[model samples]
Target: MSGDPLERIAAALERLAPGPAAAPDWDAASAFVWDAHPDALHPVPEVSRVPLGLLVGIDRQRDTLLANTRRFAEGLPANNALLWGARGMGKSSLVKAVHAELEATGLKLVELQREDIGTVGRLLALLRGAPHRFVLYCDDLSFSHDDAAYKSLKAVLDGGATGRPANVVFYATSNRRHLMPRDMIENERGSAINPAEAVEEKVSLSDRFGLWLGFHACDQDGYLAMIRGYCAAHGLDVDDAALRAEAIEWQATRGARSGRVAWQFFTDLAGRHGVRI
Candidate 1:
């Protein structure tokens, strides 16, 4: 009262802040991020993901992802997903896209990084009590020789005291089918007394994923089709022959064909034609 009304209110609020707080409860979060530095769950609201419709040239994979995602959102049993294979072929994109599609049905996608794989149990605990369905997504997930976080992942997937949340599903992408290097597996194969036992280390990790959706490099026809799809969707004015030639040239310069390459081609064509898309 002596100084200002605002100052008195601010001082009272400051006194209420918690000090030396205990670990945050997983049950309180609708979303959680694995902060590996402190090994904690950080809540987030907005997740970055593209629309499912923008994804092109992978019809089969798209349908599969959509079907699985819908099933999970509907409170039905769904598999833990593993999106593996070629890089930049829309594996990670599809996960985000599907998450967005399912949002209309009240499901959410929570993304975590590859390095934070060790904290999956903590994440699982948070999701365990969530009323909302969650899709835990990890992009570019893999393990090296010294990183043994796969064991924690395995336990959370099916072996932990608090099993995977009934309302949660996991989606991870990796270039390797077996989340470890071939040399690492081979070296273990050579050193171990039992080769079968040694290889199981890698196999068991992959085996945890109930669904395996593979992405591969696009062929010429497939690549062109993707370009045409983008052009049509964006309502860009370009004849098939002219568009085909330009897209081919773009891919040739890059020396490889993937979904990422196709999008880049579309971007350049859009600019050349003065299309705002």
Candidate 2:
């Protein structure tokens, strides 16, 4: 209805800009997924995660992360954690499992997808003054050469001027320790006038995390232990010798041995045994 050109332009811009994100019902669920487009938090009634005991071969990581999360939940000093290592080694699973284990401590789990990294500051703003503590988790996170989203992540990790909310902590899982491909880092070094500074700027994003837990590839024994643990947890009966022989063959065919592989193998074995997990 505005006749003036300036007023009309302003109205159009206002319509284009995204509205403020809605305040989430913190008590709605133990876990939530962040959606950037609509700027909302979708509650997850049932999060898919195995028990802490079922996770094998990464005891150090499990213990350390669990302690860190517990401390955060207790209102103690804690650091943002980065779980970086081999794929299918349970980086993201550990984050979820730790939160589940400590759910009674009044901690909340907020999952933010890698593509939603740019909107993290807005997400943090919504949680900044909330009463409950939050573990903002990003799974399978990494940055491409052209990606600038990592800068936004720094605001969450480093917490610019106002500083990160005491009630909120960040947890991210990535295969790369630096959250960048090796070739990308090398390219920065080769192209930039000051290679050190260039590389530092790119790699320093990972340094923001106070805790770095590395997950190595699982060995045959560890793999088998994971399978046995799953079987025991699910009450799936199997002979040790037969399980070992079949599991080894399964891994050999798949060409990798990790918690995920073990679980996949178990799923098939459970199905064959007519057992439900």
RMSD of each: 8.0, 1.2
TM-score of each: 0.83, 0.97
TM-score of 1: 0.83
lDDT, residue 196, model 2: 97
Which residue ranges in model 1 land beyond 4 Å of their true spot?
Answer: 1-34, 37-48
Clashes of 2: 0
Model 2 stretches with alpha carbons more than 4 Å out: none
Error of 1 at 131 (Å): 1.7
TM-score, candidate 2, is: 0.97
lDDT of 1 by residue, 143-185 (tens): 8887878888875567676678888888899999988888999
Candidate closest to the true structure, highest lDDT: 2
9 in model 2: Cα distance from truth in Å? 1.7
How many clashes does each candidate structure show, in the order listed? 0, 0
Worst 10 residues of 2 by lDDT: 157-166
Q: Write the per-residue lDDT of candidate 2 for residues 28-97, one digit (tens) a residue.
A: 8999999998899999999999899999999999999999999999999999999999999999899999
How many angstroms is residue 42 displaced in model 1 relative to the true structure, after the best TM-score fit?
6.2
